[model samples]
Target: MRSAYSVETVRAAERELMARLPEGALMQRAASGLAAACAELLGRVYGSRVVLLVGSGDNGGDALYAGARLARRGAGVTALLLAPERTHPGGLAALRAAGGSAREAAGGALDGRAAEDGAVAAGVAELIRRADLVVDGIVGIGGSGGLRPAAVPLAVLARASDAVVVAVDLPSGVEADSGEVRGEAVRADATVTFGTHKPGLLIDPAREYAGATRLVDIGLRPHLPPTADLEALQHADVAALLPSPAAESDKYRRGVVGVAAGSARYPGAAVLAVSGALHGGAGAVRYVGPAGDAVIARFPETLVSAGPPSKAGRVQAWVVGPGVGDDAGVVDEVLASDVPVLVDADGLRLADRAAVRARTAPTLLTPHAGEAAALLGTSREEVEAARLPAVRELAARYGATALLKGSTTLVAGPDGGPVRVNPTGTPWLATAGSGDVLSGLAGSLLAGGLDALDAASVAAYLHGLAGRVAAGEGAPVGASEVAATVARVWRDVVGGGWAAPSAGY
Candidate 1:
């Protein structure tokens, strides 16, 4: 699994490791890794012209030390110090000692002298424009907000230039913990992070600024905490988690998933939900609702029943809500079921929070921002602003596992441990009936014996992979198309003849 720790956790780990090592050892490790990555980017360091946007802390120290390394290898390196007075003394000496030169970006220009107001220094701008690469070291974990005034123009210039830009640690101006961008942030072609992956490197908004991320392990493993804030499932991890059928297992033993979805108004929801459930490895899918006829017509394999969830032929798990518009009885029946439950779509709106809280079996609530806002009596904007906090709040308030779906879908438990963020899914998944299909798939996984969080994340990942596959050749895809492609997606995940998509990381 690709795990990400919070900034606080990383800082604590760094502190502990720093205490055990000799002075400047941690910085050297970070700098050496960073220099190696830079060398790769430069193709060959011997003739490359490299510019460093120096800050006032360890971040700048890393750049300076890296610059010193490149200088020793015959690269032309220059440090453009923003905070000259507070520059790292050891790094400065290292750079000068290795044949590198330290130059002050003329207060407003790129040259080594303070420039007059409102005018660009010809020589400074020319040097920046001709550089082979630029390294962003303006801020680190200790930085509070956006780029300082001195770093703004430099970032803009780097962006406008053809030179490759690599950010150290993180793209400055992003909240490393929450992936929130407060103001102007550096957009790098690549970002080399130290110790462990930060949440911003995996999440959106901030993730967009961090082009490609690489982690540098500096022996901080012993100091790392047992739990992290987020994790991404890898191939081997998913392979281990997938359920295998036993030789003596029967359909009933495998597990049945009951889907209580759809109504006369939107009958397609039932078909899509059942399609998802069947692809999700359920022994059998029992359809329970007004749309049973529609489901039976589309999928003859489904066991159709015109009743509520309680009498839905002994299902191991129940998927409720979806398209049961204004039907209080269906919602009531789903809540009364003893099996694990997955609530989604309009059902998310109809579910009684208190009733869900009282259930002894595991309950998973999957809601997009709007539905989640309605459940919490808040605005969708509020939920989007602080997604992690809002998801955790919902989980705690309802005493259930909450899966808040969006660009970065989060799964948080009631007891408040680490929240799992789904790194899959694409913008194309914004199509209709997607959530209904997801709920049914998650219910099937739950019935197949995975825990609430695992079921939710795995279903989400598969659904997203299916969407990408169905969206092949750049055609617009429907929800049914996504459901139809789930089997192929599963095959790919299970290492059965399918290849991983070349475009994805």
Candidate 2:
């Protein structure tokens, strides 16, 4: 799993390192890694023209030190000091000793100083446009929101220029903890982050501006936290978690998933949900609802019953509510079941949060923003603005694992553990019946003996990958097609030919 720490955790780690190591050791380690990444971007450091947009903080110090490294390797490096008086003394000396030049543009001229402020701006702009690459060292974790006036024009010039932009720690102006963009931020082609992965680099908004992220270990292990706030599961971890049948296993022993979904008005939802459960590693799927006939017609393998969930044959897990209408009785029956349950769509509205919390078995709630809004007595806009807080609140309130579905699906457990964000999934998944498929897939995983959070996250990942595969060539795809494509996507994820989806969603 790829874990992401909060800004506070990162700061604590940095402090611990600073207290133990020699004064400049950490910065040097960070600078060395930054220099190596720049070398890779330039193809060859020798004879390359590199410009550093130096600010008044440690971020600029990192860039200056990296510039010094490149200078020793025969690169032509120059620094445009935005704050000459406040620049890091150690870094400035190192750069000059390595033959790097610091130039201040004349009052709108390219020569010597024309007032420090004016010269810095013009000098940085000119150097940015002419250099092969530009290092964005304008701000770091200590920075507040937005760029200082002096750094704004330089950022604009860097963005407009052909030079590749590399950010030292993080792209300036991004919220280090929440990934929110407060104001203007530099868009880097690549970012060299230090010590650990920050939540901002892994989540959206800030993630978009961060470009590609690379981590540099500064050996602050002793100070790191025992747990992270968010994480993304990898293939090896998934492989270890997926259950395999033993030698004495039978169809019943492998686990059966009971599905309560669909109504006469929306029969396709039942078919799609059952389709997802079948490929979700369940030994068998039992369906009980108004759409039983339709499910049998589409997938004869599913065991069908016309009665309520309590009457359905024994199942290890139950997936309730995809297209079920306003039927409080059916919702009650599903909620009272002895097995673990997953509630979704219309079922979410019918469910009594208090009763759900009273249940002894594990319960998972999967709700899109609209459904979640209805359950929480809030607006969809409110839920989206503070997704992490909302998901956690719902999980705590209902005493169940909450899976909030959207662009970045978040799964949170009742115990306040780290939330899992599905890194997979495409916009094509917005099609109808997609949520139904997800409900069934998560239910099947639950039946297969995984915990609620694991089942939900794994199902979400597979469902998203399937959507991407089904939407091949950029054509729109329906939910049923996504259900049918799950097998292929699962095979690819397990090994046959699945390339990691391009970094940012």
Which numbered prediction scores highest in lDDT against the true structure? 2
Put down candidate 2 lDDT per residue, 178-266, tens digits, no spaces. 76666778888888888877777766667778888888787866688879888887766665676678999887888999998889998
Tell me the spans in candidate 2 whose CA falls farther than 4 Å from its real position: 102-120, 148-150, 374-379, 472-475, 495-505
- Model 1: CA > 4 A from native: 106-125, 496-505
Model 1, span 52-115: residue lDDT tens: 8888889999999999999899899888877787899999999999999887764544443343
**Per-residue error (Å), model 1, residue 420:** 1.2
How far out, in Å, is residue 15 in model 1?
Answer: 2.0
Clashing pairs in 2: none
- Compared with the true structure, the alpha-carbon lDDT of candidate 2 equals 0.85
Candidate 2's clash total is: 0
* Worst ten in a row by lDDT for model 1: 112-121
**TM agreement with the true structure for every prediction:** 0.93, 0.89
